[model samples]
Target chain A: MKISKEEVEHIAKLARLEIDEKEKERFAHQLSDVLNHMEKLDQLDTEYVEPTSHILPIHNVFKGDEIKEVFPMADPLSNAPQKDHGHYRVPKIVE
Target chain B: MDYEAIIGLEVHTQLLTKSKIFCSCSTQFGAKPNQHTCPICLGMPGVLPVLNRDVVEFTIRTALATNCRIAPSNRFARKNYFYPDLPKGYQISQYELPLAMDGYIEIGSNETKKRIGITRIHMEEDAGKLIHGENLGHPDSSYVDFNRTGVPLMEIVSEPDIRAPEEAREYLLKLKAILEYIEVCDCNMEEGNLRCDANISVRPEGRREFGVKAELKNMNSFKNVQRALEYEIKRQVQTLEKGEEIVQETRLWDVNSERTISMRSKEEAHDYRYFPEPDLVPTVISEDWIEDVRSKLPELPDAKKERFVREYGIPEYDAGVLTSSRSLADYYEACVRLFPNPKIISNWVMGDILRELKDDERGISECPITPGHLTGMLRMIEDGRISGKIAKIVFEEMYRSGKMPDEVVKEKGLVQISDEGELLIFVDRVIEENPDMVEAYQKGKTKLFGYFIGEVMKASKGKANPALVNKFLKDRLDCNV
Candidate 1:
């Protein structure tokens, strides 16, 4: 299925990307190429082929249902661009 | 203009594996914004994806639990997209070939069992979480937390077979129960471990063709799932009645407004640009491998429910409730193994024990009173050492103080006053004071005989064995009054 230029522009807006008109046209073509490949599966004889959802035959995998240790905040906050004490410091959250 | 709503659910559950689906990054929730991530999950350049073996096993286990046929050869595809939280730009998911398919789960009470069809269960990696905030008169830009990115997820999609809101809730609950029973997923909605998106459409009665369906997202709980579906159904039915077209789109459930709002026009499957992944090879599951996994499968909820009914002589409803969780069922069976009275254990677990645990915000796994203690309490009641009411009081103490049932009974001096001679003395006093009730009892108002038993129990400080009190009160009242 071919995605129109206008649809590509609309999708780019929804995704919050600042794209030029040329890039939009390029993406439209690239996306259609990918979808065309996926569409090839439709031509295969799948009437007798079962769609697989999982690969293994196992079931009922669980932990011991015990509440374990909470995640340490220091580890995650260290990667943030800015931090105040242990909390992540972002741009002013409120006006 | 009679109409009916047909609903289906697509549930995405992160498997409880130690690592990510294709990397060694720990699959831990709530890590500092991105502490659990590595290069593979971060989508850094020069990285290759390695499929997690445990993920395949967990997915297979879920398939077996749902009675799905596992495909012998399955592979992953890259679902190409460009979202901020998706660091890789494209998510590796099963598209052309999934792991399992065509399973069904039965829901509703035994008298009205409805089979809900499961379409497929596919494995994928989770995207990161986006935290939205307020800033400068407009919604602030989002903060991406990669802690959840690349976590192994199983997306179980169901056929559009549900008809009502209650049935939808039941289907989710039963599916969650089965997942929990098999230990595939924690199924915790509060922690965002398991989430569901709903697809709903309405049709005129007896119509073979379906109306335009809306996909609802951002429902945080099962109640929200049902309510959102109900609201959408009403909205769609009203739109059709007005002779208007229902747009097929992705909608967000504004939980506060209790309505659905269009997030965006629905994207077709082609939008994903899915292709077979080149870095990984197709998984070939051998017959012996399938057999090995199958042999390790535990007795699932349905089988255990049936066993509880047949072996313990309990009602199907009670069996279902007790066997809803593996831990609860194990707890119940352990109590029976200690006491060997199915009816009595069922009553205790379903009635007093469950009530106490719920009041304390505890599950069976967190319950302080072990099966041994419960069985001991039941034994005391059966041996006439404590009245049923006193047993309840001791149970509360046992749960609160982590004391054994026998210890609590002894510490509280809650032994039953079963001495016939002692009960006779109390019965004499009741017969004298309530001469009117005695007269009424002698004059064939025999049901009023319970008044004497009540008085005797009160006189004995609620410790008098009820059966003994009843016998003494009846004999004394019959002869003297």
Candidate 2:
């Protein structure tokens, strides 16, 4: 399957990226090429193999339900673009 | 032509776990903003996430309670989206293969039982809260509180089986009761611990296909959910009747306006590129673990209701009301143990106690009147220590003062006047003062006997035993001769 220009534009919009027409066209072709290359794996007969969600062989990685000391407010808001009363401030987000 | 509303609810209940789903940050509510943030929850560079085992157990517990089929293995996925409240720009959730599926919850009363299918129950991490600054005269800025971020939540999606607003509300109440019964969630809608969003559509009667649906949000209570759905159903039916198309959208239920405003159109749909979370491994639940959780499960609402009707000889409706909450059920059982008259106890609890609790916005656990106090009052009525009318006064005092029934009776001097010597005086006085009524009774008016009985009770200040007053009045009036 090939990715279309509209699909590329849709993905860009969802990611909140403003892509020009030229960039949309270029990325459309490049992404389709990547998809076509990835599709070559479908030619192999792997029906007996189970579909894997993760690459690792490990499962059930968990920790007990207990609280640990939280990071101080200064550490997280330090990297935020805007700070307000120990909270991260950003442009207003409507529901 | 009548149109029917088709509704489905998506409920997100925050699990009562100690920590966040994938971090060790405390999951306590009402904390200062950003106080619960850790590197993993804040999405700091190169930090990995480990799932909280309690979250998984809670999900399985809920699944089993709702009669769901638990998947032997489940994996987490990253639902990529952009929101200021979500620091990682993606929420870790179960998709494609959820923790449980194909479950059902029965709503409605015994005679009209309706099964609402649960399509899936998936574990997810909640996003943080956004404190809007529009009210503060700053329309361009908002503050993000990360306290709720990464908190364990279960998104329970129901199939489109609800046919009316009442059914939708019933479905939610039943689900909430089950959750509270299992002690998995607090199910506090006002505090946002349990939030519900509804998908509603309208179709003509006898139509097989579903109409275009609009998702409704911001319904803070069960009443609001019913009202919002009613408004949406009317709006959709009107739109369809006018030969107009129903555009799919997400609508906000404005509490003040009592209307749904379109928030987002279909064109603005986000493509949440879902993929497996690389940091977290798959969860493998063994059969032994499922059975252990099953064995720990308490008797749910339906089974308890049945047992109540069978054992207590109460009506199904009474059983349902008493067993609606675990605390209320315990209260009923305690009263039954003391009084052993389940029907009368049910009447008092369901009638007077429930009304008082509702008026004060209190729950059974917070009720001032204890079960012993209530049953003690009923015992006074049973033994004729106090008339039923006088018991009401004592009950009110007991409820207000948290005192025992006998204590209230003693304080008020409201004991019954059941002795013949005490009641005979009042009967003779009533007969002497009401000569015209006696003449009327002798002339065969007959119902004037009730008048004499009323006068005797009134003359005794309502302390006269009603049965004794009746016998004395009949004898004095010569009605039995």
Candidate 3:
């Protein structure tokens, strides 16, 4: 369950982080601690215990097959950092 | 060169509940960024989570629809991850005991029923969407919209039983139909209602153990899911043939390029650091509650399809298509009850009505013609009040004016000309004018008889009853001529 230095560096890169050297060493220890704790499940007698995926037993939950309303586009771009009328605005490329 | 592609899908559907899984925020889509979020979803300090009862009920409904075995007791687990979209660093999801497991959905045509095994259906919260444009100069940083954070989502995983791209698409379509019938999720891919992430791998012919699998992401549509899987299967098989190992990685589906690019190594289930959520207790759902939900369950698609075939006497294919959506089946049955002809009702719903609705991007509810109007039109044809060709005109007028079929036919003066005496004069004139056509008809050229009949009907301004015209034309041409 221990995370090696190389593994921590790889995970950091995958997560797109610009971490310092000291932070990498620290995260290695923290991640290893978390994984070690999770590994405790392996010690339990789960031979007969089935892995659970959902919590309810109900099925066929549906609504009336009707298109209630048109696609709402009014508010998605209201709080955008930039906006051009109704769409989310971004910077132009042409000089 | 002798191998098959075995593919299976893991679909995550956001249930259309009125609130989040653990909070009271509205589960509505397309709101202002972060407007639906609160302390519980934001994972603020001292904010405890409570399970939404509706979400659990919805999960059970989906399990029963897919013929899954419901668990007597299940609990929530914290799937630990660090992402901006997920306000809680650890997402509350099902892990050790899910609500349902070991269900199967029948796909493909009736003659070739392929049973796709559903491994599990679990509940989780949706993460926020990433709006990638902040820090425009740097081209690295992206803004995150937390509006979708903590929305209730059910992740249904299927066993790797699919062997082709078409079967993969069929599985998704059938599952979406079931979801739509059961009224759990909207199943709208365009609005991000029903989304799929496919796990695919290729193996040597007749090999027992599975090969290194790659998880494909960002497939927005069912077609894209199928195409991306096909492309990945080819790429993986080629890499393995070149003696290169097919690494277990997470790949992004570049929809524009129609190829998969490796993103990172696939994480194992244990890597998520899953543990029981301390905020919520293990839910012990009662059998009485399950039975109550079951009693309220509507007739599912398969049973309805069978009934439509047996009771209505429609073909299996027509019944299948009609029962694809509950609304469509209801509309068809309503028309049938009024008209009492399954074949005619099927034709209208599957033909002009569906074509018109699809072309205009509308649904059955949006159609101008009501089921009553459609039945009235069929009745006109049945009673020989109007010809089938004229019924088409009446239908168009009905759609345009929102008028009843009888009113449209009356206003347009579209009544059939069934007057045998009046039609005999027109038939005599046609037979006298086209003597050669009559002679040709008598000489075993039966096909040309339709031409003469057409002339008679056209001469009568399309109001001539087709059956009477045929009888008059045959009598005048054969005996009198």
Q: TM-score (0 to 1) of chain B, per candidate?
A: 0.94, 0.96, 0.93
Cα displacement (Å) at residue B397, model 2 = 1.1
Model 2, CA-based lDDT: 0.90
True contacts preserved, each candidate?
A: 0.03, 0.87, 0.00
lDDT of 3: 0.82
Q: Give the alpha carbon lDDT tens digit for every residue of B1-481 in model 2.
A: 7998889999999999999999999999888788888888988888899999999999999999999999999999999988888889899998898999999999988779889999999999999988888754467888888989999999999999999999998999999999999999999898889999999999999999999999999999989999999999989989998999898988999999999999765446567889988888899999999999999999999999999999999999899888889999999999999999999999899999999999999999999999999999999998989888888888889999998888888888899999999898999898889788788789889988888877887888788889888887877778434
Pick by lDDT: which candidate is best?
2
Could you list the iRMS of every candidate?
8.7, 2.1, 10.3
DockQ of 1: 0.10
Candidates' TM-scores? 0.85, 0.95, 0.84
Q: Candidate 3 lDDT, tens digit per residue, A11-76? A: 776455788899889999999999999999888998897665446554333232222222233455
Model 3: lDDT of residue B377: 91
- Mark the 10 consecutive residues where model 2 chain A has the least summed lDDT: A69-78
lDDT of 3 by residue, B1-481 (tens): 6556777789999998887877777777777666666667767778877777788888889898999988887777989776656667788899978888999999876889989999999998888776555343324445566667878899999999998888999899899989998899989886799999888889889988888888888899888988998899889889988989988888888978888988653454236768877667667767897888888789999899999999989999999889988889999988988888899889999999999899998878898999999999998998999999999999889988899988888888999989888888888888889878778888888899889989988888888999999887777767854
Better candidate by DockQ, 1 or 2: 2
Instruction: Pick the TM-score winner.
Output: 2
lDDT of 1 by residue, B1-481 (tens): 8999989999999899887777777776666667776667778788887778888888888888888989987888988866667877899999988999999999987789889999999999998865654421224445667778888899999999999988999999999999998788999876788899999999999999988898889888988988998899899999999999999888898889999998663464337768877667777777887888889999988889999999999999999999988999999999999999999899989998899888877889999899988888889888999988898798889888889887887888889987878877887887788888878888989888666777788888999889888777767766764
Error of 1 at B116 (Å): 2.0
Q: What is the TM-score of chain A in candidate 1?
A: 0.68
